[model samples]
Target: MTMTSPVALTERQCTLIARALAEPRRYQILKEIAGQGGSVACACMQQKHEVTPATLSHHMKELENAGLIEIVREGKFATLVLKRETLDAYLRELASL
Candidate 1:
């Protein structure tokens, strides 16, 4: 799939991305998903981070809204996958600064 280039991002999108990453817990959540190299179950993340279900849901929503991750829902379970292209684009934008 084609990826969005961060250089082409609108101001609002940039703000969303920044806000999504501003919290330490959210950053850690992203790192954990990335480290998995594929989709990670929400249950796994909850155990790894020791976060409450409600808190995890909030963090996942932020990541999804920012285009930083994709969530696949199967039954009552959800799995998270990092949007590597989005991250690459963000890095590229940073390097341009």
Candidate 2:
């Protein structure tokens, strides 16, 4: 799906992205999701990161708030997908400044 581009990023969006990424755990989570090249199950992330379900949920929420990732929940299963376009836009925006 198409997403907001660098030229389209608002100040609020940039701030959210920056804030979300400031967390080391979130950045590591983002890296893992990106390295996967597709969706990663929540269970998998928890296992890899050794985080509690509650903590993982909190971090995921922040990433989602920043538009950096999308989480799809089906029944008890949850999968996360990185929003590459958003990330690329954020990076481009930073470089442009």
Candidate 3:
């Protein structure tokens, strides 16, 4: 069987992603960012989630750490972009099992 994803994810990365997504709010946050298509503003996320700034930051940090998203900072504004390749790799790995 031909089985391989173009992008590869390390076991550690997959574990991290699984753990991060295990959190309901984090999963929702990821979905919202993905739904935006690209470059979602942190301010808009906070407003939509109605969570405290610190709480949002924590969630973003976890996603970033899991390599599920990237955070770009300019001045005081922060933007998030979904790491589709990484997510895709993780999904591929899961499907392999």
For model 3, how does the per-residue alpha-carbon lDDT over 8-72 read when each residue is reduced to its tens digit?
Answer: 88889999999999999999999999899956999999889878999999999999999999999
- The deviation in Å at residue 39 for candidate 1 is 1.9
Sort by TM-score, top down from the best? 3, 2, 1
Which scores better on TM-score, 2 or 3?
3
Among all candidates shown, the one with the greatest lDDT: 3
Q: Which of the numbered candidates is closest to the native, going by highest TM-score?
A: 3
Which 10-residue span in candidate 3 carries the lowest summed lDDT?
Answer: 3-12
Pitting candidate 2 against candidate 3, the one with the higher lDDT is 3
Per-residue lDDT of candidate 2, residues 1-97 (tens digit): 9974344689999999999999999999999999999579989999988878899999999999999999999999999999888898899898888
The 10 consecutive residues of candidate 2 with the worst lDDT sum are 1-10
lDDT of 1 at 42: 89
After superposition, the stretches of candidate 3 with alpha carbons farther than 4 Å from their true spots are 1-5
For candidate 3, list the clashing residue pairs, or say none: none
Which stretches in model 2 have alpha-carbon errors above 4 Å?
1-7
lDDT of each: 0.86, 0.91, 0.93
Per-residue C-alpha lDDT of model 1 across residues 5-55, encoded as one tens digit per residue: 443666687788889999999899999888889579988998887778898
lDDT of 3: 0.93
Q: Return the candidate ranking by lDDT, descending.
A: 3, 2, 1
